[model samples]
Target: MASTSARDDDGMKERLRQLGLRPTRQRVALAKLLASGGHRHLSAEDVYAEARRAGIQLAYTTVYNILHQFTAAGLLREVVVESGRTWFDTNTGPHLHVLDEESGHLQDVAIDPKALPLLNHLPLGDDVEIADVEVVVRVRRRNDSA
Candidate 1:
Protein backbone atom coordinates (compact mmCIF):
# COMPACT_ATOMS: atom_id res chain seq x y z
CA MET A 1 0.00 0.00 0.00
CA ALA A 2 2.77 2.39 0.90
CA SER A 3 4.63 1.67 -2.31
CA THR A 4 1.46 2.14 -4.33
CA SER A 5 0.81 5.47 -2.67
CA ALA A 6 4.36 6.61 -3.43
CA ARG A 7 4.02 5.56 -7.05
CA ASP A 8 0.72 7.42 -7.37
CA ASP A 9 2.32 10.57 -6.01
CA ASP A 10 5.17 10.26 -8.47
CA GLY A 11 2.80 9.80 -11.37
CA MET A 12 0.74 12.82 -10.32
CA LYS A 13 3.83 14.98 -10.02
CA GLU A 14 5.10 13.93 -13.42
CA ARG A 15 1.70 14.52 -15.06
CA LEU A 16 1.37 17.97 -13.57
CA ARG A 17 4.87 18.87 -14.68
CA GLN A 18 4.13 17.80 -18.23
CA LEU A 19 0.98 19.96 -18.24
CA GLY A 20 3.04 22.96 -17.02
CA LEU A 21 1.13 23.20 -13.75
CA ARG A 22 3.04 23.86 -10.53
CA PRO A 23 1.39 20.91 -8.73
CA THR A 24 0.47 22.80 -5.58
CA ARG A 25 -1.16 21.19 -2.58
CA GLN A 26 -4.73 21.58 -3.84
CA ARG A 27 -3.79 20.73 -7.41
CA VAL A 28 -1.91 17.60 -6.40
CA ALA A 29 -4.80 16.54 -4.22
CA LEU A 30 -7.40 17.01 -6.95
CA ALA A 31 -5.19 15.55 -9.64
CA LYS A 32 -4.73 12.44 -7.55
CA LEU A 33 -8.48 12.01 -7.30
CA LEU A 34 -9.08 12.57 -11.00
CA ALA A 35 -6.13 10.72 -12.53
CA SER A 36 -5.75 7.82 -10.16
CA GLY A 37 -8.72 5.57 -10.78
CA GLY A 38 -8.41 5.45 -14.55
CA HIS A 39 -10.44 7.65 -16.93
CA ARG A 40 -13.47 9.50 -15.54
CA HIS A 41 -15.91 12.28 -16.35
CA LEU A 42 -16.60 14.85 -13.66
CA SER A 43 -18.14 18.26 -13.32
CA ALA A 44 -16.64 21.04 -11.25
CA GLU A 45 -19.34 20.64 -8.62
CA ASP A 46 -18.75 16.90 -8.49
CA VAL A 47 -15.06 17.48 -8.06
CA TYR A 48 -15.69 19.92 -5.21
CA ALA A 49 -17.99 17.47 -3.51
CA GLU A 50 -15.36 14.76 -3.73
CA ALA A 51 -12.77 17.12 -2.32
CA ARG A 52 -15.01 17.96 0.58
CA ARG A 53 -15.68 14.29 1.18
CA ALA A 54 -11.92 13.72 1.25
CA GLY A 55 -11.46 16.53 3.83
CA ILE A 56 -9.82 18.79 1.29
CA GLN A 57 -10.69 22.47 1.84
CA LEU A 58 -11.44 23.49 -1.72
CA ALA A 59 -13.85 26.22 -2.80
CA TYR A 60 -16.28 25.82 -5.71
CA THR A 61 -14.74 28.71 -7.58
CA THR A 62 -11.32 27.24 -7.04
CA VAL A 63 -12.49 23.94 -8.40
CA TYR A 64 -13.79 25.61 -11.55
CA ASN A 65 -10.56 27.52 -11.97
CA ILE A 66 -8.45 24.42 -11.54
CA LEU A 67 -10.59 22.46 -13.95
CA HIS A 68 -10.34 25.21 -16.54
CA GLN A 69 -6.60 25.40 -16.01
CA PHE A 70 -6.25 21.66 -16.44
CA THR A 71 -8.33 21.79 -19.61
CA ALA A 72 -6.25 24.62 -21.02
CA ALA A 73 -3.07 22.77 -20.10
CA GLY A 74 -4.26 19.77 -22.14
CA LEU A 75 -4.44 17.56 -19.04
CA LEU A 76 -8.21 17.30 -19.42
CA ARG A 77 -10.81 17.58 -22.17
CA GLU A 78 -13.92 19.71 -21.74
CA VAL A 79 -17.24 18.28 -22.86
CA VAL A 80 -20.14 20.68 -22.94
CA VAL A 81 -23.44 18.89 -23.25
CA GLU A 82 -25.46 22.05 -23.06
CA SER A 83 -25.25 25.74 -22.24
CA GLY A 84 -24.78 25.25 -18.50
CA ARG A 85 -23.66 21.64 -18.33
CA THR A 86 -20.00 20.87 -18.83
CA TRP A 87 -17.92 17.89 -17.89
CA PHE A 88 -14.18 17.34 -17.69
CA ASP A 89 -12.95 14.09 -19.13
CA THR A 90 -9.69 12.47 -18.13
CA ASN A 91 -9.20 11.01 -21.57
CA THR A 92 -7.64 13.68 -23.76
CA GLY A 93 -7.96 11.77 -26.98
CA PRO A 94 -10.78 12.50 -29.41
CA HIS A 95 -13.91 10.44 -28.84
CA LEU A 96 -17.67 10.66 -28.69
CA HIS A 97 -20.01 10.64 -25.68
CA VAL A 98 -23.51 9.46 -24.98
CA LEU A 99 -25.38 11.45 -22.34
CA ASP A 100 -28.36 10.04 -20.47
CA GLU A 101 -30.85 12.82 -19.91
CA GLU A 102 -32.66 11.28 -16.97
CA SER A 103 -29.53 10.31 -15.05
CA GLY A 104 -27.28 13.08 -16.36
CA HIS A 105 -24.58 10.46 -16.76
CA LEU A 106 -22.13 10.37 -19.67
CA GLN A 107 -20.43 7.35 -21.17
CA ASP A 108 -17.95 6.86 -23.96
CA VAL A 109 -19.41 5.99 -27.37
CA ALA A 110 -17.10 3.89 -29.50
CA ILE A 111 -17.90 3.85 -33.21
CA ASP A 112 -15.96 3.55 -36.41
CA PRO A 113 -14.95 6.90 -37.91
CA LYS A 114 -15.98 5.70 -41.38
CA ALA A 115 -19.58 5.36 -40.21
CA LEU A 116 -19.81 8.97 -39.02
CA PRO A 117 -21.22 11.70 -41.21
CA LEU A 118 -18.58 13.86 -42.84
CA LEU A 119 -18.56 17.62 -42.46
CA ASN A 120 -19.24 19.02 -45.90
CA HIS A 121 -18.29 22.54 -46.97
CA LEU A 122 -17.28 23.92 -43.62
CA PRO A 123 -18.04 27.62 -43.27
CA LEU A 124 -14.54 28.86 -42.62
CA GLY A 125 -12.23 31.53 -43.86
CA ASP A 126 -9.77 30.97 -46.65
CA ASP A 127 -6.91 30.53 -44.18
CA VAL A 128 -8.90 28.44 -41.72
CA GLU A 129 -8.48 24.69 -41.33
CA ILE A 130 -10.72 22.23 -39.59
CA ALA A 131 -8.94 20.47 -36.74
CA ASP A 132 -11.39 18.26 -34.87
CA VAL A 133 -15.07 17.58 -34.35
CA GLU A 134 -16.87 16.81 -31.11
CA VAL A 135 -19.93 14.62 -31.36
CA VAL A 136 -22.25 14.19 -28.39
CA VAL A 137 -25.30 11.98 -28.74
CA ARG A 138 -28.03 12.33 -26.12
CA VAL A 139 -29.88 9.12 -25.34
CA ARG A 140 -32.47 7.84 -22.88
CA ARG A 141 -33.38 4.28 -22.02
CA ARG A 142 -36.66 3.06 -23.47
CA ASN A 143 -39.38 2.27 -20.99
CA ASP A 144 -40.46 -1.35 -20.95
CA SER A 145 -44.19 -0.53 -21.02
CA ALA A 146 -43.85 2.03 -23.77
Candidate 2:
Protein backbone atom coordinates (compact mmCIF):
# COMPACT_ATOMS: atom_id res chain seq x y z
CA MET A 1 0.00 0.00 0.00
CA ALA A 2 1.24 3.43 -0.88
CA SER A 3 1.47 6.07 1.77
CA THR A 4 -0.79 9.11 1.53
CA SER A 5 2.16 11.37 0.79
CA ALA A 6 3.33 9.13 -2.04
CA ARG A 7 -0.15 9.01 -3.55
CA ASP A 8 -0.47 12.76 -3.28
CA ASP A 9 2.91 13.30 -4.93
CA ASP A 10 2.00 11.00 -7.80
CA GLY A 11 -1.31 12.75 -8.27
CA MET A 12 0.31 16.18 -8.26
CA LYS A 13 2.94 15.07 -10.75
CA GLU A 14 0.34 13.73 -13.12
CA ARG A 15 -1.80 16.87 -12.82
CA LEU A 16 1.18 19.13 -13.46
CA ARG A 17 2.17 17.09 -16.48
CA GLN A 18 -1.32 17.33 -17.91
CA LEU A 19 -1.10 21.11 -17.50
CA GLY A 20 2.28 21.11 -19.32
CA LEU A 21 4.13 22.23 -16.21
CA ARG A 22 7.24 20.54 -14.88
CA PRO A 23 6.41 19.16 -11.45
CA THR A 24 9.43 20.18 -9.47
CA ARG A 25 9.69 19.22 -5.81
CA GLN A 26 8.46 22.59 -4.63
CA ARG A 27 5.64 22.64 -7.16
CA VAL A 28 4.54 19.18 -6.18
CA ALA A 29 4.58 20.06 -2.51
CA LEU A 30 2.57 23.23 -3.10
CA ALA A 31 0.12 21.45 -5.40
CA LYS A 32 -0.46 18.77 -2.83
CA LEU A 33 -1.16 21.39 -0.22
CA LEU A 34 -3.57 23.25 -2.48
CA ALA A 35 -5.33 20.07 -3.53
CA SER A 36 -5.68 18.57 -0.09
CA GLY A 37 -8.74 20.47 1.04
CA GLY A 38 -10.79 20.24 -2.13
CA HIS A 39 -11.37 23.77 -3.51
CA ARG A 40 -10.21 26.98 -1.87
CA HIS A 41 -9.05 30.57 -2.39
CA LEU A 42 -5.57 31.10 -1.07
CA SER A 43 -2.93 33.77 -1.26
CA ALA A 44 0.81 33.17 -1.36
CA GLU A 45 0.95 33.98 2.31
CA ASP A 46 -1.80 31.52 3.08
CA VAL A 47 0.00 28.79 1.17
CA TYR A 48 3.27 29.64 2.86
CA ALA A 49 1.62 29.39 6.26
CA GLU A 50 0.11 26.05 5.39
CA ALA A 51 3.46 24.74 4.14
CA ARG A 52 5.13 25.79 7.34
CA ARG A 53 2.41 24.08 9.41
CA ALA A 54 3.02 20.94 7.37
CA GLY A 55 6.78 21.21 7.98
CA ILE A 56 7.56 21.89 4.33
CA GLN A 57 10.60 24.10 3.80
CA LEU A 58 10.43 26.52 0.90
CA ALA A 59 10.79 30.20 0.16
CA TYR A 60 7.85 32.59 -0.21
CA THR A 61 9.02 33.59 -3.67
CA THR A 62 8.95 29.94 -4.71
CA VAL A 63 5.28 29.72 -3.73
CA TYR A 64 4.44 32.95 -5.51
CA ASN A 65 6.20 31.86 -8.69
CA ILE A 66 4.58 28.44 -8.68
CA LEU A 67 1.16 30.04 -8.18
CA HIS A 68 1.62 32.27 -11.22
CA GLN A 69 2.86 29.29 -13.23
CA PHE A 70 -0.18 27.30 -12.23
CA THR A 71 -2.46 30.17 -13.19
CA ALA A 72 -0.79 30.46 -16.56
CA ALA A 73 -1.17 26.71 -17.09
CA GLY A 74 -4.93 26.92 -16.32
CA LEU A 75 -4.44 24.85 -13.19
CA LEU A 76 -5.67 27.74 -11.03
CA ARG A 77 -7.67 30.95 -11.36
CA GLU A 78 -6.52 34.30 -10.07
CA VAL A 79 -9.10 36.44 -8.27
CA VAL A 80 -8.30 39.99 -7.28
CA VAL A 81 -11.01 41.46 -5.09
CA GLU A 82 -9.00 44.48 -4.00
CA SER A 83 -6.02 46.43 -5.16
CA GLY A 84 -2.73 44.64 -4.48
CA ARG A 85 -4.58 41.62 -3.06
CA THR A 86 -4.93 38.43 -5.06
CA TRP A 87 -6.34 35.03 -4.33
CA PHE A 88 -5.67 31.81 -6.18
CA ASP A 89 -8.74 29.68 -6.70
CA THR A 90 -8.64 25.93 -7.21
CA ASN A 91 -11.98 25.83 -9.00
CA THR A 92 -11.06 27.19 -12.40
CA GLY A 93 -14.55 27.48 -13.80
CA PRO A 94 -16.96 30.25 -14.73
CA HIS A 95 -18.56 31.54 -11.58
CA LEU A 96 -18.98 34.58 -9.41
CA HIS A 97 -17.68 35.17 -5.91
CA VAL A 98 -18.74 36.88 -2.71
CA LEU A 99 -16.20 38.73 -0.63
CA ASP A 100 -16.68 39.11 3.09
CA GLU A 101 -15.58 42.63 3.90
CA GLU A 102 -15.18 42.01 7.60
CA SER A 103 -13.23 38.78 7.45
CA GLY A 104 -11.60 39.33 4.04
CA HIS A 105 -12.61 35.86 2.89
CA LEU A 106 -14.11 34.80 -0.41
CA GLN A 107 -16.93 32.38 -1.13
CA ASP A 108 -18.35 31.03 -4.34
CA VAL A 109 -21.65 32.43 -5.58
CA ALA A 110 -23.89 29.95 -7.35
CA ILE A 111 -25.79 31.55 -10.21
CA ASP A 112 -26.61 30.61 -13.76
CA PRO A 113 -24.46 32.44 -16.26
CA LYS A 114 -27.33 32.68 -18.72
CA ALA A 115 -29.52 34.36 -16.15
CA LEU A 116 -27.31 37.41 -16.15
CA PRO A 117 -28.74 39.74 -18.80
CA LEU A 118 -26.01 42.35 -18.40
CA LEU A 119 -23.42 40.06 -19.94
CA ASN A 120 -25.35 40.02 -23.19
CA HIS A 121 -25.14 43.78 -23.70
CA LEU A 122 -21.48 44.58 -23.41
CA PRO A 123 -20.51 47.61 -25.53
CA LEU A 124 -17.47 46.29 -27.31
CA GLY A 125 -16.19 47.28 -30.69
CA ASP A 126 -16.00 44.87 -33.59
CA ASP A 127 -12.29 44.50 -33.18
CA VAL A 128 -12.56 43.72 -29.46
CA GLU A 129 -13.80 40.62 -27.67
CA ILE A 130 -14.50 39.78 -24.11
CA ALA A 131 -12.14 37.20 -22.67
CA ASP A 132 -13.58 36.64 -19.18
CA VAL A 133 -15.80 38.30 -16.62
CA GLU A 134 -15.06 38.42 -12.92
CA VAL A 135 -17.77 39.67 -10.57
CA VAL A 136 -17.23 39.85 -6.84
CA VAL A 137 -20.05 40.94 -4.56
CA ARG A 138 -18.75 42.44 -1.34
CA VAL A 139 -20.71 42.07 1.89
CA ARG A 140 -20.32 42.90 5.52
CA ARG A 141 -22.27 42.50 8.74
CA ARG A 142 -25.15 44.95 9.15
CA ASN A 143 -25.35 47.23 12.12
CA ASP A 144 -28.42 47.29 14.37
CA SER A 145 -29.04 50.99 14.09
CA ALA A 146 -32.10 50.56 11.98
Candidate 3:
Protein backbone atom coordinates (compact mmCIF):
# COMPACT_ATOMS: atom_id res chain seq x y z
CA MET A 1 0.00 0.00 0.00
CA ALA A 2 1.25 3.44 -0.87
CA SER A 3 1.85 5.80 2.02
CA THR A 4 -0.24 8.94 2.39
CA SER A 5 2.65 11.24 1.45
CA ALA A 6 3.36 9.15 -1.62
CA ARG A 7 -0.27 9.33 -2.66
CA ASP A 8 -0.25 13.08 -2.20
CA ASP A 9 2.91 13.41 -4.28
CA ASP A 10 1.38 11.33 -7.04
CA GLY A 11 -1.74 13.45 -7.02
CA MET A 12 0.26 16.64 -7.18
CA LYS A 13 2.35 15.19 -9.98
CA GLU A 14 -0.75 14.32 -11.98
CA ARG A 15 -2.23 17.77 -11.39
CA LEU A 16 0.92 19.45 -12.57
CA ARG A 17 1.02 17.29 -15.66
CA GLN A 18 -2.58 18.13 -16.47
CA LEU A 19 -1.69 21.80 -16.25
CA GLY A 20 1.04 21.27 -18.91
CA LEU A 21 3.77 21.81 -16.35
CA ARG A 22 6.61 19.43 -15.79
CA PRO A 23 6.52 17.92 -12.33
CA THR A 24 10.02 18.47 -11.08
CA ARG A 25 10.98 17.60 -7.52
CA GLN A 26 10.92 21.22 -6.39
CA ARG A 27 7.72 21.90 -8.27
CA VAL A 28 6.00 18.91 -6.71
CA ALA A 29 7.07 19.96 -3.23
CA LEU A 30 5.84 23.50 -3.71
CA ALA A 31 2.59 22.39 -5.35
CA LYS A 32 1.87 20.03 -2.50
CA LEU A 33 2.40 22.80 0.03
CA LEU A 34 0.16 25.20 -1.88
CA ALA A 35 -2.66 22.69 -2.35
CA SER A 36 -2.44 20.76 0.91
CA GLY A 37 -4.67 23.04 2.93
CA GLY A 38 -7.85 24.73 1.76
CA HIS A 39 -7.52 27.56 -0.74
CA ARG A 40 -5.89 30.68 0.62
CA HIS A 41 -3.80 33.65 -0.45
CA LEU A 42 -0.03 33.61 0.09
CA SER A 43 2.87 35.78 -0.85
CA ALA A 44 6.20 34.57 -2.20
CA GLU A 45 7.80 35.17 1.17
CA ASP A 46 5.01 33.25 2.84
CA VAL A 47 5.64 30.30 0.55
CA TYR A 48 9.36 30.49 1.14
CA ALA A 49 8.81 30.39 4.85
CA GLU A 50 6.46 27.41 4.58
CA ALA A 51 8.91 25.59 2.40
CA ARG A 52 11.63 26.10 4.95
CA ARG A 53 9.35 24.83 7.68
CA ALA A 54 8.75 21.72 5.60
CA GLY A 55 12.51 21.28 5.16
CA ILE A 56 12.34 21.97 1.47
CA GLN A 57 15.55 23.72 0.53
CA LEU A 58 15.14 26.18 -2.26
CA ALA A 59 15.89 29.78 -3.02
CA TYR A 60 13.34 32.57 -2.79
CA THR A 61 13.67 33.29 -6.49
CA THR A 62 12.81 29.69 -7.30
CA VAL A 63 9.62 29.99 -5.33
CA TYR A 64 8.78 33.25 -7.03
CA ASN A 65 9.42 31.77 -10.48
CA ILE A 66 7.37 28.68 -9.80
CA LEU A 67 4.53 30.86 -8.47
CA HIS A 68 4.55 33.01 -11.59
CA GLN A 69 4.67 29.93 -13.76
CA PHE A 70 1.72 28.44 -11.95
CA THR A 71 -0.17 31.70 -12.28
CA ALA A 72 0.47 31.79 -16.03
CA ALA A 73 -0.77 28.22 -16.33
CA GLY A 74 -4.08 29.12 -14.67
CA LEU A 75 -3.34 27.04 -11.61
CA LEU A 76 -3.21 30.18 -9.44
CA ARG A 77 -4.49 33.75 -9.45
CA GLU A 78 -2.37 36.82 -8.86
CA VAL A 79 -3.69 39.62 -6.64
CA VAL A 80 -1.82 42.91 -6.59
CA VAL A 81 -2.65 45.03 -3.57
CA GLU A 82 -0.31 47.83 -4.56
CA SER A 83 3.01 48.56 -6.18
CA GLY A 84 5.62 45.87 -5.44
CA ARG A 85 3.16 43.80 -3.41
CA THR A 86 1.34 40.69 -4.62
CA TRP A 87 -0.38 37.60 -3.38
CA PHE A 88 -1.05 34.30 -5.09
CA ASP A 89 -4.45 32.76 -4.54
CA THR A 90 -5.10 29.05 -4.85
CA ASN A 91 -8.78 29.64 -5.57
CA THR A 92 -8.84 30.60 -9.20
CA GLY A 93 -12.60 30.89 -9.40
CA PRO A 94 -14.52 34.14 -9.41
CA HIS A 95 -14.65 35.60 -5.92
CA LEU A 96 -14.13 38.82 -4.00
CA HIS A 97 -11.58 39.51 -1.32
CA VAL A 98 -11.55 41.37 1.97
CA LEU A 99 -8.10 42.78 2.69
CA ASP A 100 -7.00 43.82 6.14
CA GLU A 101 -5.29 47.11 5.61
CA GLU A 102 -3.42 47.04 8.88
CA SER A 103 -2.16 43.46 8.63
CA GLY A 104 -1.93 43.10 4.87
CA HIS A 105 -3.86 39.88 5.03
CA LEU A 106 -6.40 38.73 2.47
CA GLN A 107 -9.53 36.73 3.06
CA ASP A 108 -11.97 35.43 0.49
CA VAL A 109 -15.48 36.81 0.63
CA ALA A 110 -18.60 35.43 -1.01
CA ILE A 111 -20.37 38.12 -2.96
CA ASP A 112 -22.17 37.71 -6.25
CA PRO A 113 -20.50 39.56 -9.04
CA LYS A 114 -23.88 40.53 -10.45
CA ALA A 115 -24.62 42.49 -7.31
CA LEU A 116 -21.88 44.96 -8.14
CA PRO A 117 -23.57 47.80 -10.03
CA LEU A 118 -20.41 49.09 -11.66
CA LEU A 119 -19.92 45.92 -13.71
CA ASN A 120 -23.34 46.40 -15.30
CA HIS A 121 -22.13 49.42 -17.18
CA LEU A 122 -18.59 50.18 -18.29
CA PRO A 123 -17.40 53.22 -20.23
CA LEU A 124 -14.96 51.30 -22.36
CA GLY A 125 -14.90 51.12 -26.13
CA ASP A 126 -16.96 48.44 -27.87
CA ASP A 127 -13.85 46.57 -28.95
CA VAL A 128 -12.83 46.10 -25.34
CA GLU A 129 -14.05 43.20 -23.24
CA ILE A 130 -13.60 42.52 -19.58
CA ALA A 131 -11.58 39.36 -19.01
CA ASP A 132 -11.86 39.30 -15.25
CA VAL A 133 -13.01 41.46 -12.34
CA GLU A 134 -11.15 41.54 -9.04
CA VAL A 135 -12.77 43.46 -6.23
CA VAL A 136 -10.82 43.95 -3.01
CA VAL A 137 -12.48 45.73 -0.12
CA ARG A 138 -9.81 47.06 2.20
CA VAL A 139 -10.65 47.43 5.89
CA ARG A 140 -8.91 48.25 9.11
CA ARG A 141 -9.68 47.66 12.75
CA ARG A 142 -12.09 50.21 14.20
CA ASN A 143 -10.95 52.64 16.86
CA ASP A 144 -13.86 52.60 19.25
CA SER A 145 -12.69 55.49 21.41
CA ALA A 146 -14.10 58.31 19.35
Give lDDT tens digits, candidate 1, residues 81-111: 9999999999877678889999998998666
**Every model's TM-score:** 0.79, 0.85, 0.86
Stretches off by above 4 angstroms in model 3 are 123-129, 141-146
Candidate RMSDs in Å, in order, are 3.3, 2.4, 2.2
Q: Ten-residue segment with the worst summed lDDT in candidate 2?
A: 110-119
Q: What global local distance difference test value does model 2 have?
A: 0.88
Error of 2 at 44 (Å): 0.7
Error of 3 at 66 (Å): 0.3
TM-score of 2: 0.85
The candidate, 2 or 3, that scores higher on TM-score is 3
lDDT (CA) per prediction: 0.84, 0.88, 0.91
Error of 2 at 41 (Å): 1.2
Q: After superposition, how far is residue 112 of candidate 1 from its true place, in Å?
A: 6.2
Q: Candidate 1: worst 10 consecutive residues by lDDT?
A: 112-121
**Model 2 regions more than 4 Å off:** 1-4, 124-131, 143-146
* Full ranking by TM-score: 3, 2, 1
Tens-digit per-residue lDDT, 17-65, candidate 2: 9999998999998888887878889988999999999988999998899
